[model samples]
Every structure is written in C-alpha cells, then in structure tokens.
Target: MNTIEFLLSRRSVSVKLITEPGPDDEALDRILRIATRVPDHGKLTPWRIQVLRKDGQARLGDFLAGRFTARHPDANEKQVAFERDRPQRAPLLLVVTAKVRKQHKIPELEQILSGGAVCHNILLAALAEGWAANWITEWPAYDDEVVRLLGHDPETDRILGFLYLGTAAEAPDERPRPELSDVVSRWPQTA
Candidate 1:
C-alpha cells in the first residue's frame, strides 16, 4: 500500500480481538528496526523495547494480580483473575520505555515524545507486515511496582506504551474523524 493510502486507512484492532500467530523473531526484529527509525535530535536513543512473550505475559499477569490484591484487600477472586489475565489478552506485548536523561542537552519532554513516536512506528510497522497491533498504557503502566517488575527504574524510565501484536479476528470498522477545516488553522494573518 502507498504511504498516503496506508496512513488514511490505518486503524488499531482491539486487543481482545487480536489472536495468535504474531510476528516471529525475524519479523519482530525487522519491525523493531523500522520502529527506531524515527527522528532523534541528539542521537541519544532515549527509549528501549522490552519483549514480553507468552511466559513473560503470564508472569506479568500474576505480578499484576498480586499487586492488585494487595492494594484492594476487599477485592473478590474475579477481580484478581481479571488482573491476572489482562496481560494475556494479546499474543505478544512490547513495552516501550522512555529513558529520559535529565541533564542531557535534548529536553526530557523531547525524549518522552521520541518514545511515543517509537510506539506509533511499531504500530505502523506491524500493520505494514500484515499484523494487527494496539498501543496501550493502562493502570499497570503507571504503577511503580509494575515498572520495577518490568526491570526498569521507575525514576528514570517511564512506560510509554504496551504494544500488543497479533492477527486480527476481524477487521475493525473505521470510526468517525474530525473535519480538517475544524482542526486546521492558518498561522499568519492574510488580509
């Protein structure tokens, strides 16, 4: 597909609708290569990718369940199970971490934005490779314990997104979009 057409037609498949047969190791490596090709101001690659395969997903799910149970002592078994199964929704999960350098010449905000671009690029690359993907950062992404469970210091690293990849059970319908005239504006005045 051409660039314009691809951009216009791109949409995220829901995580629950994503099935198995995700990208293999070689394809995943290629996708990651493309994902990192975004703009970097100072050549400081301020992001990292963490691959959470099947077993890792289960482990993360268990960890999340434990954390949830601890925080919500009055929670029922169903709620705990929900937390435990959350990470297993997708076949593969890629955690994009924004490693912001406070003293670097490049601002911290730019570094964080770079991580966001990485997530978008991953989604695009997966779609181009005929795989459905979704970028998400739910409750676990913000929790300090979850960050530590992912093996990163919560102080310096932030979870930009959890990219879920797999085959789509069914194509998602296009949702309504904003009108260009309503969103776009001219910068300078023309009398």
Candidate 2:
C-alpha cells in the first residue's frame, strides 16, 4: 500500500488477540528508532520506552496484583488475578513514559504531548514492522505506585500508555471512523 493508503487503513488489533512472535531484538530496535522520530519543538526528547517481555512481564504483573490486593482488601482472587495477568496479555509490552520538563520555555503540555506522539508513532512503526499493536492506558497508568515500581518519578513523570505488540492471532474487523465533517474544521467562517 502507498503511504496515504497505509495511514488510512492503520488500526489496532485487540490485545487479547495479540499472540506470541512479537518483534525480534533487531525489529524492536528498528521500531524504537523509528518511533522516536516524532515532532519535538525544543527537541527535549522526554519520552521513554520500557520493554516488558516474559520474566519482566511476570514480575510486573505480580507486583501490580499485590498492589491492587493491598489497596482493596475485599478484592477477591479473581479481581486481583486480572491485574496480575494484564501484563502478560501480549507477548511484548512497551511502557511509554513522559518525563515532563517543568519550569522551562517548553510548555508542560507540549512535553507531555511529545510523549503522546511517541505512543502513536510506536503503534505506526510496529504495524510497519509487520506486527499487531495497540496503545492502552488503564487505571495502572495513573497509579503512583505503578510508576514508582517502574522506577519513574510520578511527581514529574507520566505513563503515557502501555503499548502491546505481537502477532495477530486473527484478523480484526474494521470499525467505523469519524467523518471529516465531525472532526475537521476551517480556520475562517463563510457567509
């Protein structure tokens, strides 16, 4: 497909449907390099990508479950297990974080947005690399303990998303996309 066609058809496959055979070390290296080549006004480069696979995923899952159980004593085994298994849902997970530089000429929002761009770029790059990918940020992304566990300073840093990349077990159906009229606009008004 051409560049425009590729962009128009780009969509995420479900994480549950994402199986093993994720990008190899070399492919991941290429994806990461391509993912970071996004717009940065001041070139702050505030984004970070943490790869979690196999042992790393298991450890993170256990820690997240423990934290969840500690916070909610009434949570049953099933509830805690959900958190525990989240990280292992896919063969590979990339924790995209933003270390916002405050008190700088670069606006905090801009720095944070740079990280957001990195998140999307990752998805695009993964797809380009012939891998199924999705970007997700559930409750854990906002949890301070989770950030701390990942060795990031929650005070100044934010978890943009957890990018899951792997081979697609099955093809996902295309969903409806917003119309240009609904999302696009003109700078100047007519009539």
Candidate 3:
C-alpha cells in the first residue's frame, strides 16, 4: 500500500490475536532502524529498545506472576496464571524505554514524547512489513518491580510501550475515529 493509504488504514491488531512468524533478525534490525527516525530535539536519542523473545517473554511472565502473587496474597491461581501469561501473548515483544536526561537543553517532556514517537514508528514499520503490531503499556509498565525485572532503571527510565509484533491471526476491523470536522479548527478566525 502507498503511504497515504497505509497511514489512513493502519490499525493496531490485538496482542492476543498476534501469532508467530514475527520479524526475524534482519527484519527486526530494519524495523528498529526505522523506529528511531523520529524528531529528537538536541539529538539526544533518549530511548532504547529491549527485545523479549519467546524465552525472555516466558521469564518475564513468571517474574510478573510471582510479583503479583506476592503483592496480592489473596489472589487465586487464575489471577496468577493471567499475570504469567500476559507477556506470552505475542511472539516478540519490544520494550521501549525513555531515558530522560536531566539538565539537558531538551525538555524532559520532549524526550518522553520522542520515546512515544519511537513506539508509533515501530508499529508503522512493522505494519509496513506486513506484520501485525500493537503498542501497549499495561500495569507492568507502571510497576517498579516489573520495570526492574526487565533490567531497566525505573528511576531514570520509563517504559513507553510494550510493542507486540507478529502475524495477525485475522484482519482486524477498523474502529470508530474522530471526525475531522469535529476535531480540526483553524486558529485566528478569518470571518
């Protein structure tokens, strides 16, 4: 598809519906390269990508499940299992971390936004490569323990998103979007 068509039709496929046959080593390299091509004020590439393969996903799931059980002593087996399976939903997971630098010319907010842009770019690049991708920041993204488990310094880094990448089990239907007329407006009225 062309750029315009791709931009208009692009939609996130659910992590649960994302199957195997995700991008391989070379494809992932290209995707990562594309993902970093975002607006970074001061050129301080204040972000990083951590890839979680099948084994890594399993380990993360186990860690989360253990943490959940510890935090919620009354949790049932089902709840623990749910936590354990969270990261296993996709074949590959990309953890986007925003390493905000202090005392830099660029504002912290802008650095964080750059991280967000990185997430979006990853999604678009994966889609362009005919792969289904979804960007999610669930409870783990906010959980310090989980962040540490992923080897990220929760103090200096924020988890921008957990991008799930794989083949779509089936094409996703488009959801409702804001109407341009309702959302767009020109500043400084001419009338």
lDDT of each: 0.93, 0.92, 0.94
TM-score of each: 0.96, 0.97, 0.96
Q: Which candidate would rank higher by TM-score, 2 or 3?
A: 2
**Candidate 2, residue 48: lDDT:** 89
Worst 10 residues of 3 by lDDT: 182-191
The parts of candidate 3 lying over 4 Å away from their true place are none
- Candidate whose TM-score is highest: 2
Per-residue lDDT for 102 in model 3? 86
Clashes of each: 0, 0, 0
RMSD of 3: 1.1
lDDT of 2 by residue, 1-63 (tens): 888998988989999899989989999999999889988879999878899988999999999
Q: Where does the lowest 10-residue lDDT sum fall in candidate 1?
A: 182-191
Q: Clashing residue pairs, candidate 3?
A: none
